[model samples]
Target: MNHGTEFSRRDFIKISSLFLAGSAALSTLPSGIVSGLGSNPMNGKGEKIVYSFCEHCFWRCGVAVHVSDGRVTKITGSEYHPLSNGKLCPRGTGGTGLLYDPDRLAHPLIRERKGGKQYYRKATWDEAITAVAGGLYKIHEQHGPSAIAMLHHGFGVSFFKKMFSEIGVNKIAKPSYDLCCGPARQATVLTYGYPSDTPEGFDIMNSKYMLFFGTHFGENMHNTAVQEISEGIRRGAKIVVFDPRFSTLAGKAEHWLPIKPATDIAMMQALMNVLISENLYDKEFVEQHTVGFAELWEEVKEMTPEKAATITDISADSIRTVAREFAFHAPAAFVHTGRRTNWYGDAMQRIRAIQILNALVGNFKMPGGVVAFEKYPLPQPPPAHEHPAYEKEVHSKYPFFPKDEPSNTIASHEIVQQAITGEVKALFIYGVNLPETMTLGRQTALEALQKVDFSVAVDVLPAEVTGYVDVVLPECTYLERYDDLDNGRAFRTPFVALRQPAVAPMFESKPGNEIARMITDKWGIHGVFAPTVEAGLDKKLKLAGSSLEEIKKRGVLVMPATDLYRKPGEPLNLNTPSGKVELASAQLKAGGFDAVPKYTKHPEAPAGYYRMLTGRKPMLTFGRTANNRFLGDLATAQENEVWVNTTVASKHQLSHGEYVHLKNQAGIVSEFPIKVKVTQRIRTDAVYMVHGFGHNAKELKWAYKRGASHNQLISKTDIDPAMGAVGFQNNFVTFVKEI
Candidate 1:
């Protein structure tokens, strides 16, 4: 176990510091490598390059890890990968920070009751795996397979998912579903008959006009999306942004309408009304390729720009101008269906309005507009083993929740509630830090964690959730492990990316594949996974006329770009119920929901409380990078500050750069104090703060108590009835002068 530290912790920090300084230490590395130093590496003796994909965020950009003397020195974007296209984001190049983090979960841990209190004791891999498997099996035997569920976030969880399928346990949920991508995905499915893919099915680079509801493209830092948006900007694309705060993307907009919070539906309806009333819509296309035009018109006709102006606080003239300009752009114009659209409770309908606007403009499948990208056509190998049919698959109570995604069966918040009610007995928390995750709230998440009969956490960091779990399995970082091949993402050029190890896993940490294999073996189930992770990957690749060895050279096997544009006179063979765009979804109406998007007024903030808004900083992706000190080195990334409107701050007698705590409507105070950012970038009615801070886990030394906990202040949640996506923007907060 003593792999005598060839690179001391101090040495690693020094190297990182040098990299950060843009010094000659990493000058020989490839462009987009460590610290954004773009240089071609001249590989000399004892140097090698390993091609792999990054796990910093879900974009999964391919990276070329440079190894010198058996240490990962730097990472650069792989030219062969479609997502990165030889450009890397800041977070992608900071993988070394995560791998070398001193606070990383170094060994498996088992909770022990000592002195009438619980604490974690380091255990061997065998002991930990056995305990976890035994406990979960006992729960399955006593309560049935339906009692077990998994809440996962990263690609590494695929191995554990396969292991659970062996025991007929299929209830899986991802917190990102309820929090980020669920609304956009489900709304697209209802309107277009197919789910929206990543990049949200937009042809950003070719677009002449882009309308964003509340999407913060520049700040979110989704690699490919940002790259394309930059290209669009260079090509003279006009942008329109409607948001309560003047976000990073808003600053680049041709028009930044400070639309009132919770009144987006009313504004969207007005846009639709303008297109219809002024005869600005694509009449021929709508008549030929869409249904429910009459229903849509009727719904929006009464919601005039003047009426919407009153509700949204944007001028009627501006709304009319944006609508006309949008129509002027024709098929090259499109309304973006924003990510994390789970704001308020009517997210499904809110996004439905965006889809309708795009449809009216006849932009579907058009260049410079909306187009559905294709995924790589990699052939799947035969199942490793067949299992018995599940007694009953857990289902979401929400009617329109996606049933096609094989991984998730219900909402993550539903799983939390189930655990609280004793319906779910066992849980596997994989790569998600539940306490900071805005599912229901930190208190509700803690309650669920405490109520679960048996819980196991597979993570790389000892996050707050780990302290409450029965077993903690140490997972190696992506740079030191292999996950399943990633062909899930759809893109312009379909490709399958690899996740090969750049270096051996440090300490006692093991890959998810190995951990899953051990658990299946303990259950007397063999061949659920291949003999080895490499063997399985090779087998699947071989079926697709490729090999693991071939993919390792480039980090990805790419397919030729598919035709994104539909030819004129082509039949609109859509997957919807009517085989056409549904301006008013019949599926929604049949489910007893609104057929057409409707404007519903949400609750107003109380007397002194302001609506609290949450978002992420560009350099961090919530919990994944919260403890990553390399990314945190920047002053801007160290902690989250509450951005209060200058007028509101003045009214409250609050000074800029002053620390203050926040108290929510339910009388819950923020765990830590946040610095005040008195700025004119936000509206007077609401305040904004970046999410994923105020870490309660003392083990996360770098992230602990860095800022206020946005999730902790979220005492109220609005769940969309149609899709079950959770919305936390309903929570309102007032400044607390004292901690």
Candidate 2:
């Protein structure tokens, strides 16, 4: 159960910085640590196993790691944990390749530019940490802490969030909710007291019917949800999906509506209209739990199924049939709150429309409907400050989403725009691959990075972001680190799970806590963080009358099960101001936003242009797997083809498998010319591609120039009125045959 260290050729070793060495057991180690590191074999020809969590994606499935002689040999789903349930996806199984990626940052590197060329040189840990502290402090003095903005990604976000808050930096950019899930959360919270969408909230397993839009759950492959879907299907739950492509989930669904892109709102409005006019809504539940029933009906009376048919191109009869079927199932049916919902400017209204349908059916807290995710009072380290670190956020256009406040996030477009103007002078990017993920183009990202006086990137592999930074600090991969205790806030369970290092930190890399401490110490503020991640877990465990030593032996501690669903006739309280389910939000109306969901037309692609869109690959999550050799051999990597409609291809005399060049409105051509898959699966006016390909960093040997970057094709974005999230589908592109 003990972990060790794998030192690099720097001829330096320091276990004191890594707070994991705190214990009476470490007293048994050799007094001379550096002499031991050069030839140390902690495993000593014996087998070792450890329990940890997957770091491939945010799902964070519980995993078991088997280390043979200090090298990770295998990783599999833990049978005892709820998320994994003894099943692992392609991403989780391929984690070992990421841990041993040859492209990994071997040492601290300083971005050195001489004459006309830019290059990197190896730097010692001392030199790099001092540069970071000095550079950041310099910016703080000249422009105040707000001049430094950050984009926190991966599980290490909590560390940066706390550090930035302590430094009094007002702009610690959070992108996930605001840019990825903002609309869904805001719409859900505005309707109910809390968010209607959580990883554990919806009882998809017990449902009789389910509906989806945009999100492809089967293709995304969250182990727990995939397992739950299997259970639901076995019980005869009818599934329906609406997407531009015939995704894996669409193939499995009883009905797949190949609606036009960015038109999910129109279809949903038509469905709601039918339910209201036909008297299919739950009259009893509406009277008991909500307000503004009549006004809601009045607002949507004209949005008939036929009118929606013209907008979404889904037949009026098909729309009416699905609406009736959904309503017929009553409280046993669900409208799935989808992920990756920030596709259009009207995203919040669309999500609100979907959630409103659920409330109208009286399905909010039922066993077969959407339920609340329970949180357990676990042990933890005390806060750095007595009260909250940040003040109440100022009002925005759609000031409703507060799962993690949207106002706190620097908008995808806003961050770069501000950075280009020298308003944001320094940036400390943690785990975020901004060049690939965010829109407004790869050029925009580089320009923003260049505009900053100081920029530091912390990562394992040499990503596109690394080429844009002034300094790069190599961080230990999750396999060789201890992170915050895995509290099941996102899952259906109330438990505490540990993420222990199965293998020693490779090379000169350090874990998140150690990195945080080093920077904070040099930055002259060290009291903000607990001494170690384990210490924080111990404090949390002690509050619950448990100890870290007790959980360490077992690996996880699941609490007694409690009902997450509301029972019949149960009185409940809400986080909303009025403490009631708001069918019409007073807060929204007060803020001059539409209280009821409304459908507005989105901008169409130019006459000769095709709209650009993106989706996830089950084998890869957000294309961060580009550097993983195992994933590169997983079939899709070789074919990394752009999906063009057969009808559109014919007009341009293009054929399948031919390399096609895409030119966006901004005149930026894709970095890689992609093989075209001319098929009927996608819409005629739009082309699709799996995101996370076309990484241009030559250091990333496996992923460079492999496929195409969706980010490269998108030069402009529309911000969501609700949360300042980027509308990812706003860009348009035209084709050029790469003959």
Candidate 3:
């Protein structure tokens, strides 16, 4: 264990010889070694192959796990997969280490008393189930089922929804909407009349021109998108990137327009003006497939490149050039829908504007451009049962729910505040880490936990949010669980895969679906939860017309081949009210937002302060994978690095790798180590940092003090007026030297 001890020459020779012998042995092993020990470097001996989906970030790429005697040896992308094409990102490969992590919760834990800081000894499954059910019954008896809120996170989500519905708790929330992808989905639905879940696939490989506005498909590793985009560029497609920082995608782009932060809407509007003024838009396609063009024309007529230059700080001439190129490119041009649109106020409107621009060029639903299609295949199941008694007890406050937001729409910050105010009596959180994900301060969520009567968190590791829970239940990683891959919508192919347990669950951990089933049985709501899961699975299988057991055995399934693009006169059903891609959305007007896509001035950063913009790092997947030793070791410091522009660094007299305190408008400051990325590629008025850092949890020993949290420097001052999405980028912060 002593790392510093020097080795003798003889000892060094012995070590080198052993290593060479091991390498030689590995070379002689079979390609698919079934054992842990083998000559092949890629394969191990006695390895049990299991199919599963990656949960590192939500691409849900199919993976194969190599398990040996109940231990997962390695994880690789399913070579037989039709979507990922046998490719796995670094985060997916590192997921194996998470299963055997020392910090993983081994058993259920409960607080000794209400509002207590310390937890009692680990309890048995029966005890944990009984306690949770008893607490819910108590809260129901006193207040009502409405007092109990179920906050679900991550995959296997439909299972939780069934449990909450059966248990008669009508209050439910998910972190996805307000914190991440909500704005994009909501905007797409409002404008087009259909949810963005069935996103229009971008034919990057076939396109001649691609425009990216803050959408980094390469770094985010959206399997199909990344592969296609890269191929398209190699085949001579021109890529233009518009962002405040030189993102990984921007670096590979043909042109990088490093505009000021939050100025994307202005740039897009300017492009629209150019297309209209020059008469370069697709006239035939627009007249046939769109409505409200006159209204859109009237609104955009005044917003010329010259007018937009004042707000966006881009040269008018450059905007005109890009616009003409994109419009004239016709069938070979596309505007990609970027992830993480829930970062600023009016983000929904911003996305609508971008999508409208794509439609103006007649790029919608065409090959070599943006095309609309259906992708996911459903799995098979059993039968349905009833829970009439429980159904009657459901809260009426959420009757409008699953109607407007079929998905959970409650914001994380608002849920925490309600818990603190005693509006919520009980909460069960699964998979997500609210302390790190929520825009509100960590202390605010912790205080909310203190006020709640009961809280249960099921996770792989004892995250910071676990400290605030009444019960902490350990859940198995993807490598040791059974999951269906049919849930994801394929952009490039029609395929379905199965995620079988590669190894038995480590310790007492269980799959999230199984856990939900157990809780359902305990609450005597078997009729509801049992039938729902069975019926849902059955519906999926019938859709595929395949046997569930056979699909499980094969580990992968593919639906009958269908046209990837929809044909004309196919009874196209647009989710928008007008039943077409709306150039001007009526829903926005009803919601008090601009009906026509219009650009607004970006919020100005205060003097002496920089607009602190946060995004993902290539190495890290939010805050979840930071605890993995293999991935953590790849970076020198296992935390976030604040990237300061050389201009700003010089102004502050700060050097690279120095510690600094990032102070926000609300006076909340986070002290973190900084790294100066001195490049003219980033805007001088902005500072950049990767999100999912700044761990305050004492239990995360490796991540505790590694980096500063960008979330800490973001105030809860701005929210998207239309959809209540958090304005994370609206924040302005000043960096002070840390003494």
Candidate 4:
């Protein structure tokens, strides 16, 4: 694929400076490139173009879809979009694969018993909408709206959220929170006074030094982040990575220290000790812009490098050397607060340690350091007539669980537990395949699904979740649908991008807006949505001082780059209770949690088992691309392989390319055999597997039984008491060789 223009070190520095300086205007595509491609039926080559954003992963990079004879031909990166920068990841370019998948749900279905066996029967849109609306309304009337909940993923969920909100059902949750972004988000809020955003609030392109703790950047393949990291490498930035496995990002690091798993907090404390004891940290910055240093030092004073070396299995001298080097790059260095950070139950404090490290180096808002980017300041149109006040949201037990996140009030695992307990009677599963998702595990997800009184699944594919739901609404793919305005992402150049259709909805599938509208209409609710999805989009755009017509041409409307660097001696006015960076969080302390990060040992693997760590392929997102044949065409993308360390493989008498069924600590065996990859890249104590595979859904022809299910092996999970994030790394698995 055409990844985009390769930048020289000088070119990268020049572009990065100009891009972040708030002076340079964003460049647009040449007018002729897409001239006469939209409205004209025949553009000489009988092709047309549509500007939309990708749905393959949450990065949401803008895409230029080329259509020929009423079908999508190809997808490329939109040069105008800030996130993509005219470059596309492997998944971004594979939209056609998902759009045209044969396993896609062609029509709405309702579960019906046939000959004493339950199975799905085809239903019309009206029938499906009526069933969903009636069930939800009945549940709301009988148990109040608190018993109705929605667990969703993807951009298409906005409309469904509106539908549920109108009836006062606010128990909405995204599995991404409990599983992926929650710990980092809440930790940053406590430490930096703002939640972290994608591209992760860093100036990667200009950084002179970068530190990562188990953050697999290159492997994660977030478009803008990867591009900036490449630029940073070209600019001769030094990198340090601390991970059990030698990940793709580690390969580029100046130092890749394979630290012991679950001992990251101890390593971080040791680094803090070095920075303080060696007088390498910036005292001026710390004094001027932070609070609670005394409390922080008190906690880390005894966590010397030698003591940490014993705990973390890294040499004391090496930890000191890394600390000094990190300090030497002051103001331009940052320890990356990683994504999917809920590794141990102490993830919140772990990230707090990382935040403190960044603060000690005085990197907050500095050039090439930790900087919060702004979102496009697009004004919202007034809500479509206010309804009665929503029920006082039922709060989760976790003290620091975020109540402000509109999309989620409770953790997903809580929702599952509530479902199984019969507290939540109705469920709306949008785009998320629960059995394959890491909420608790396959058994728990299935139990919840079976126990729920009514469950409706809105999805494009007939995923495993759909088979268990009472009703299935076939929502069209991103290529054929329009989601709400996507200005949620914060970036260097603030922008609002559009998700216009590239082709009409295929088969009996409808876009989410239409499905949501139909259901609300069945409930006798009106005016919640505009006359049409496009009309509502146009109205919202006009409110933002732009129109749909104008934005459709470029797919996005961008604001000038915000000035990211701090001026000399500028007073820091953060939003935290202290109005400054909190080295030791008073909020956490008040809540009876640790004021400063503390290290605690986690459970060790049993004699014949290893900790089962999970991640994703750069080309595949969990569940989303599991059945994308075009992406799966690559040998590496076909299935997930269990990466066993060379020594461990020998000990288990397993050879490379052999197949084995993973048996977890709970004695739950993988249904399918996974290929064994004997490599020295990973540590012996832990085995790694890419998540989002092992599809059992026969409807997913391309993905069925492709690999072992990582989620299924996770019989145990550690829940963060403060933030409610779920950590599944505690699960250990041993290999059972396939006959």
Candidates in order have lDDT scores of 0.86, 0.74, 0.68, 0.85
Lowest lDDT 10-mer window, candidate 1?
7-16
- Which scores higher on lDDT, 1 or 2? 1
Mark the regions of model 2 whose C-alpha exceeds 4 Å error after superposition: 1-45, 196-200, 385-398, 401-409
For model 4, give the RMSD to the true fold: 10.6
Error of 1 at 522 (Å): 0.1
Top-TM-score structure, candidate number:
1
lDDT of 2 by residue, 539-623 (tens): 7788888887887664677777667677688875777766777777777787778888787788888888888877878878765
Instruction: Determine the backbone clash count of candidate 1.
Output: 1
* Candidate with better TM-score, 1 vs 4: 1
Q: What TM-score fits each model? A: 0.94, 0.91, 0.88, 0.94
Candidate 3 segments whose C-alpha is farther than 4 A from its true place: 1-45, 113-117, 198-200, 377-406, 488-490, 527-543, 566-573
Say which prediction, candidate 2 or candidate 3, comes out ahead on lDDT: 2
Clashing pairs for predicted structure model 1, backbone only: 31-38
Model 1 reaches what TM-score against the true structure?
A: 0.94
lDDT of 1 by residue, 1-739 (tens): 1111210110101011111112332333333434432333556858889999999988899899988766777788888898999988888887876877767777788766544445567788899988988989888898899889999999998888889988888889999988788888999999998898776799999999999988988888999999999999999999999999999999999999999999998998999999999999999899999999999989899999999999999999999999999999979999998788898979988988999999999998998988999998888876767767453233335888888886677889989999888798788999989878989999888878877778888998878888777788988899999999999879889999999998898777899999999999999998788778899999999989999999999989999999999999888889999999999899989988899989999999999999998888888999999887668887889999999998889888899999999999999999899999999999999999999999988777789899999999987889999988999898999998975
Question: Tens-digit lDDT track for model 3 on 1-739?
Answer: 0101110000100011211112332333233332322223434456567776777876777787766644566677877676566888777777754665556676777555324223355678988888777777777778877677777666766666667766466566776666667777766676566556533467778899898888876666677567777798788989899888888888888778877677787788789889988999998777877888988889888888998888777889889989988986867898877777766667787878878888899877676786654665563354344333224211232221124553464555567777778777677887778767655656566666667777778887767777666667778887777654455565556677666677778667888778878887887766544344334454566677765566665567765645656577554577677788888887667655688866666577888788887777655787678777657767542666677778878888877777777887767778565555555567888888777777766566557777778766766546676666667777788876664
If ranked by TM-score, best first, what sequence of candidates would result? 1, 4, 2, 3
Model 4, runs deviating above 4 Å: 1-44, 388-396
For candidate 4, the 10 contiguous residues with the lowest summed lDDT are: 7-16
Better by TM-score, candidate 3 or 1: 1
Candidate 2: which pairs clash? 379-540, 379-541, 380-540, 623-692
Instruction: Name the lDDT of candidate 3.
Output: 0.68
